[model samples]
Target: MASLCLTCVSEGTSLEEQVRRIKDIEAIESDSFVPQAFKSSRDDTKSAVVQVKQESEKGPSQDISLPMSIVYDDSGTLAHPSLFVDKETAEELWLNRLISLRQERLMGSPVT
Candidate 1:
C-alpha cells in the first residue's frame, strides 16, 4: 500500500478543480484509488491524501507513502499541472513492480 499527500496550488483553479484534474489522470485507474481532498493545515493551501494497495505474494500488504505536489502557473490560465513524487518512493515502487513481474514470469502467469 502507498499513501501520497498531494498539494495543488493554482491561481486559476480552485481546489476542487485541481482534485478533478488529479482524478482525471489516465495513469491512475478509476478503480485503483480514490483521493480525499481537504484544506491543508495552513488554511491557505489544499491537500489530498491518496492511498494505493499493491498486491504481492510476499505477505499480507505493505504500506508506502508517496507524497506529491502540483503547482500551476500563476497566469490564471490553467497551466499544465504536474504531480511530483519523491525519487526514493518512485524507485522503491518501480523495484517492487519489477520484482512482481519477475515472480509472475517465473510462475508462468500472464502479466497484466
Candidate 2:
C-alpha cells in the first residue's frame, strides 16, 4: 500500500489516486502506533512490565488517559467524604473511600 501525506497529497495527486491509496490503507490493519511517525526509540519492555505489575498490585485499574487534581473540604456536619472528581475518576473514588473512613473517625464513628 502506498502511503501519502493526507494534507499535502491532495494538492499533488489526483482525487482518484488519493482514493485508491486510502482504500489500500484501509485494506491493511495498521499497528497501534505508526512506525514512521517518530524516530526509533529504546523499547522499555522491562519498565513497561514493572509498571503493569505495580498498577495491578495496587488493585482495580481505570481507563482515564489524562491528568487530574483533587482537593478535600473538612467542614461538613454530616461528615461527608469530599469526592473531588477530575480526569482521574478512579483515584477520586479511592480517595473518597479513604476520606470517608477519616470522616467517620472524626464523627466518633467506627471506621469501616
Candidate 3:
C-alpha cells in the first residue's frame, strides 16, 4: 500500500513524537503541525489536494479554491482511513489486493 499509494503520513525518518500522541488527537492538534512535513511533488500540492478532495466526494470541483477539508478523513469509524493515489496505482491495487487491508474490513471479512 505504501509503495502503490500516496501515503497519509509523511515519509519522515521517524514518527516517534507523533506516534506517542496518535491516540489522543487533541494533543496532536494542540501542537502546530509543521506543514512542510509532507514531501513535495512535481505538480506540487495542488494536484494532490485536488485528488484528495475529489475522492472525498463532497461535491463537484468548481475549480474554485476549495478552502476546506483538504486533509479530510472520510473513513469515519473504520479502523483505517481512505487512500488517495493515482488511477494506475488504484487499479493495480484493486486487482492485486482486492478485499484486503481496508477494503477487507469494510466488507466485514477478517483478513487471513
Candidate 4:
C-alpha cells in the first residue's frame, strides 16, 4: 500500500522551508516501493492536497470524475470522495467485452 502526505506552510515562511518540503516529498516517493504521489497543489485556502492512484495499465481516461468509496485494509471508512478512474470504467468494460468476444471466436473455431 502507498500513501502520501501533503503539508502546507505559511506564506511568511523562509524559502528554505518550502524547498525542504518539496525535497521531502520527492524523497518519500523515491524511497518508497511504489511511486504514487501526485504533484501537490494548493487552492485559495492554501491547503495542499496529495492524491495517490492505484497503478494500472489503463491511465486516466474518464470524462467525468466519479465519486469513490476507498476500502482500506484497516477497516477505515472514506466516503464520497471524487476520484479519477484511469482509463475509466468505460475502457474497462470495453476490454472485458473484447476478451469475451475473443473467447467466443475461439470457441466457434473447429478443433484441428
Poorly placed runs, candidate 3 (over 4 Å): 1-82, 99-112
RMSD, candidate 1, Å: 21.7
- Number of backbone-clashing residue pairs for each candidate, in the order shown: 1, 0, 0, 1
lDDT, residue 66, model 3:
43
lDDT of 2 by residue, 2-76 (tens): 566677475788878787778767655555534455653343222221122124666777444332322334366
TM-score, per-candidate, Cα-based: 0.28, 0.22, 0.16, 0.20
Error of 2 at 36 (Å): 60
Q: Estimate every model's Cα lDDT from 0 to 1.
A: 0.65, 0.60, 0.52, 0.56
Model 1 bad stretches (over 4 Å): 1-82
Best by TM-score: 1
What does the lDDT come to for candidate 3?
0.52
Deviation (Å) of 20 in candidate 1: 37
Q: Please give the TM-score that candidate 1 achieves against the real structure.
A: 0.28
Tens digits of per-residue lDDT, candidate 1, 1-85, equal 2222255453556766776676566437657767778765553344465677776797877676554555334555554433356
Better of 2 and 3 by TM-score: 2
Measured with C-alpha atoms, the lDDT of residue 18 in candidate 2 is: 81
Name the lDDT value of residue 11 in candidate 2: 75
Error of 2 at 88 (Å): 1.4
